[model samples]
Target: MAGTGICCASLEEPIALMKMGLSMVLIGHVNFLLGALVHGVVLRHINLHKQARAMEYAISNVVALTSGLVGIVVGILAIVLSKNKKSKGLTWSLFTVSLTAALMAAASAIGLSVITNECPFDPTRIYSTTLILWVPLIVTCVIQMVFSARCFAVCISFLGLPCCPNRKRTRPYGRAINVVRPLKGSRPISQY
Candidate 1:
């Protein structure tokens, strides 16, 4: 907390970290259950001898399941690590895993949409059922992304990294210097 900046000071608090961990775990579980339901629906259609809905939904659901499991593991790690003084590496790892989970969720959403749009309409309403189930998944994934972003903000604080917009260092005159110049030559035009 000493050298870490003020923007993430609140996230550094033990209580807040714990709350994030718990919420991540909760979302992970939700994602897992929803993923399973969607996968089961696909499996059922397969059993009934229906052509798979472009196979896109299955792939996305599998990715969602994997990401859900990762989220659960990372959430547990966060909870355990938060209880003690956390190492920078561990914190970064948690952030990375959470970030991956968020990205996977976004991919899943896109894959789900692709299946709905690209697959031919079915007389049995399988597509509609999967789409209905997907609504909750999209909502849950959005929540996961929010949590991942929060984790990223905390990581920046933990690692003493500069804030995003302020990452570039300014010269003495308060402007950034992005040009190269020979000490004996005229000033580079780009610098002007």
Candidate 2:
């Protein structure tokens, strides 16, 4: 909802919206770090046992699922306000939320490793190792990878210049094309 407001306000003035967007991005990153810390604490202290681990995993999964549902609600609200326009503000907010969720999952995995005092399950050891060894690592990696990729992509899009060249055709019938160049010689593209 905040993102929708910012984006709507931004349509009136690009500069203000740009500043707001940047701030939202920063807030998202901060939330991600906080979520990681929270997840680490929960996994380390709450889910260390074999039987308790199952319950903790279930609860965590429920929370994650609920978060996703909330994101969908926010997305829908943004869309309704924007009349179906692609909402950059809402996108930024959702991206931030997703990044935070991913970080939390990763922290959980790390905490689990610390508690186990053993290397996380290796798939190659499946035949020789216990089911307990295989399940947690596999599930953690799958969930972590999905969210990590999303967070990384959003971060790159916000902070880095486009890597793929932006090409434009000069004429409908002409063979010439132009590559719009970025401002150069100041700093690396990633810094901005």
TM-score: which candidate is best? 1
Candidate 2: worst 10 consecutive residues by lDDT?
A: 76-85
- Residue 135 of model 1 has an lDDT of 84
Alpha-carbon TM-score of each model against the true structure: 0.69, 0.32
Pairs that collide in candidate 1 are none
Q: Write the per-residue lDDT of candidate 1 for residues 73-191, one digit (tens) a residue.
A: 66776676577646766877876886787787777666655544455445367776777888888778667766766766666667666564333345536867586556777786768
Residue pairs with colliding backbones in model 2 are none
lDDT for each of the candidates?
A: 0.69, 0.42
- RMSD (CA, Å), candidate 2 to true, equals 16.6
